[model samples]
Target: MATKRVAADVPVVRVDGRELRPGQSFQGIEYRGKDKDGNDVWRILVYAGDKWVETPDGKRKRVVKTDKHTFTGTFRDAKKFKAKLEAERQDGTYTPPSKETVAGYLREWLDTTARRALRPSTHAIYEVNVNKHIIPALGHIRLQKLDSNTIDRFYSSLEDKLSPATIMKIHTILLSALSKAKADGIIKQNPAKNATPPRVEDPEITVLTQEQLDRLLETAKGTRIYALLYTLAYTGLRLGEALQLRWSDVDLDRGVLYVLHKTKTKSSIRAVSLDDDVVAVLRQHKEEQDEIKEIEGERYQDMGLVFATERGTPPSPSNLRNRYLYPLCAKAGVPRINFHALRHTHASLLMAANVHPKIISERLGHASIETTADRYQHLFPTLQAEALEQYKEYRRKHGKGG
Candidate 1:
């Protein structure tokens, strides 16, 4: 009833309206067919370079084409291919707002919004949180597609792995990034707005007893690093802030240290009185630094940093911790607490000494008095006992017996 169909490879491919040369590659094929109504239908078969591709519904599809061509396949096959390609094209059109990840957004937010508006020390802390925690976990996720569920899962996983304080830091970073994204219209919603950070129950702060402090000072004697530990424990300066200090910031005559710049907290900028012992140690340190500068000759940069390397250059935080602090603590036979613990010790000692909470708050440069009170609330019983004793003394003076 019908003539035999041509063999499957009988040179059916055409190029530029002519039969293709033998052995020439069939870059693609094109054809036209008539339906029952005799309407002409056209389609194109694309070569590798002729069309662009995209993924849609987890499948590959052709999104764009360079040239139009006719089709040879059945209508059903043609329609299916066209639909898949269209889906891919449409999906490609729906681009996320930014190409950056969650971590990248945090950096951008800090540079654009925080650095200009917030204090320098505050910016530094945000930078730390972004680098140490947030980027490592969720930096690869696209900003627009980062939904609440994704953030919830990230938090849940962090809860199992990190300390509560560390988890809280991660949450703070995410909240800040999402808030900026919302304000900029990069995201339609703030997924982190309702999220709760991990609860950080206060732990007992360790303070060096007077005897231990004396032993530490004795052990540190005759070493240049001793001045570093003495400064931290006696003055309560943070390690970064201490490292950033310049000789100019010290007021030896007035026995005061001006903390105008800190490498840790934004609120850690205030003047503090120095004890005589601390002043003496600093004076000795300055003399040692000057001698080293003389030895180094022109190599010394004279950066004016109080805690500097032998070359008179500013000391890096890591190098100072490894080379000086850790080794000195080990030699002193004390538990190897990090440099930050020195700050805790200072606060704890002040609390133990019954310093006013408001004064402590101002000295530490905390954002609010409430934060200071919350941190040292455990010392209130001591304050309360002192108050009761004062009341008894008043009663005794006024002839009101117990």
Candidate 2:
């Protein structure tokens, strides 16, 4: 009887043909290898065209040269390769997230929430806070794993590294992000909800004394930055609001300046009475702008801004601060403070002058009367003194002596 053949019993290479030419082809079944146990591991027949071919034999395997220049070689056993390919297909190991970073999420949140619910300028501020501060610190951290302890550590680092107001802004950004995360189910709860932000001490405000104000005005005469300083001091308009102001908003005939729009706060949309000093400064400033327009002829772009660059674009906050406000303060020999501090100085001086808190709130366009009282309460006399004065006044006016 003929002996049966097993795959491992065969050698690695075999062939049926004896010799090969330059341009012919052949077919064969090739066995890749066998398991530990010797077995005839068979695969489907393979056709080779002009390639080196592995031919299987009962006792030996051999490489054969075909008629063509190269012959195709096929594996007779493919259990291992098949298993690996199926496993790789099942694993599915190559995909990326829809949103990748905190900065990215913040931008999406601003587009979706802040833009829809808040003012455009308010949304712009949130974008500034995210880009300038928050993204640099913790943007790489995954939103889902952001815990209260992580936020606490971030706030602690900011308190030591940055200004109090900057830290407060960072806290505000984190709170807003985490609140959105909770709403979207990215996190179970807001980590920043109960997180204690760093307590910010109010910085000292620089208010010009009457002597200092008079001296500064005298020094600012004949300069382009003069009326801007006067408007900041007298009307308490923020830098952007002042820059956005048009001649139409100013009713010189009615002696009232209408703050119909603002860039700082949403509440800053009301009218303010123009006192004599403010009116006089505006008149002079208008005359200067008109002269410039006459000199430039039609080349000048006229937006009618109360405060604008000579070329007619709006004045940038930093440009106004550095080039105008700072030099003016230095020249006038007054202590330098930020343009924002001008607003605070206006409020503080009003409180010192015993202006009613309600009126001060209205002038500053505060959302609530309590906001004004809370900010300026320290400058006022004690509550007891106020109560005693009220009682005395009431008695003097209404009490009848027997």
Candidate 3:
């Protein structure tokens, strides 16, 4: 009979290395060899203060933290490792990091601090990065054992498969989490502090020409999603902010909306003005929704979303584009772009019409006018052309040049 090959298991960080209780003093170092670096490496040791820690091979040993010549993070070959510890003891210069694993600390941080500090959507993203990416790769390494070189190598491996933006996000999670560990005295210093993360390019913008926008609206006018399409083009609400909306958020009489949620920063929350056209569409949509509610009666879920499935629940944002917007865009003789193109299109249209950037920022719920300007920087060349023409006209009128 042939034996089947089994995949090797990954190493796990051990939490019981230094079991010394406070007020109990530890003396002497045990010389253990380089760890087996294999399955039997999972030797969990527990000893009374005076007893010896035995290696799996029957010799006595204890894995201690070291700053140099490390075999497994801080763990080194026990003979030289013991000499270093003894010297540190004589000099009184040794400080030990906690025996916590990277995975363990990250779980705690997410459950306690990150869950409270970040928005739900943002927390979800962080959770995915930590649990899915960081944990699987570095979880076995002790938090104190984690070093810049290890982190850099991990990032280098991800570069081909993941975008620099994604790698940067992973770096941000590590830097922030490790900084917290340092603050709590879990580690002496964050190894990630000096690590280099990948550089990210500015987000690409996609805006439609006025002719395409007109054709799209003309085709969309009487469709079920027209109100949504029009709202996106006019108000620039992100797909999430738009989908998360309730009837209460819309003020038809005031021609405004209060955007309470979106991805990224908290600064994305702001009030947006509705054009008269958008207000009219919203009003009609509301009346129609109200009539549907009356008919559906007890069966209506009443989620209060402005855009919803026929059953009144918020549909997945991804599905909304493929099912409605993309097909409609194709039929309308316009090149298809992602749903966010409407936001870019809205901002571009405002800039082309020479509207103030502050108003554009407010309408788009951007954190600042600087953000608006940066996003629309591509449009500024046309602005310069228009300005040059105005300057020539002024010169002709004043007779300074002919």
The prediction achieving the highest lDDT against the true structure is: 3
- List ranges where model 3 is wrong by over 4 Å: 1-30, 33-96, 262-266, 399-402
Give lDDT tens digits, candidate 1, residues 42-100.
45443224444656667667555343434334444555655554464465432223566
Kindly give the stretch of ten consecutive residues in candidate 3 with the minimal lDDT sum: 39-48
Model 1 clashing residue pairs (backbone): 31-70, 31-71, 43-70, 43-71
lDDT of 2 by residue, 135-188 (tens): 787788766556778778878877767887877877887787778866665555
Model 1 backbone overlap count: 4
* Alpha-carbon local distance difference test for all models: 0.70, 0.68, 0.77
lDDT of 3 at 135: 94
Query: Which ranges of candidate 2 are over 4 A from the true structure?
Result: 1-103, 115-125, 263-266, 348-354, 382-402
Alpha carbon deviation, residue 130, candidate 1 (Å):
6.1
List the candidates' TM-scores in order. Answer: 0.64, 0.65, 0.76
Model 3 — TM-score against the truth?
A: 0.76
Give the C-alpha lDDT of model 2: 0.68
lDDT of 1 at 65: 35
User: RMSD in angstroms, candidate 2?
Assistant: 16.2
lDDT of 3 at 383: 86
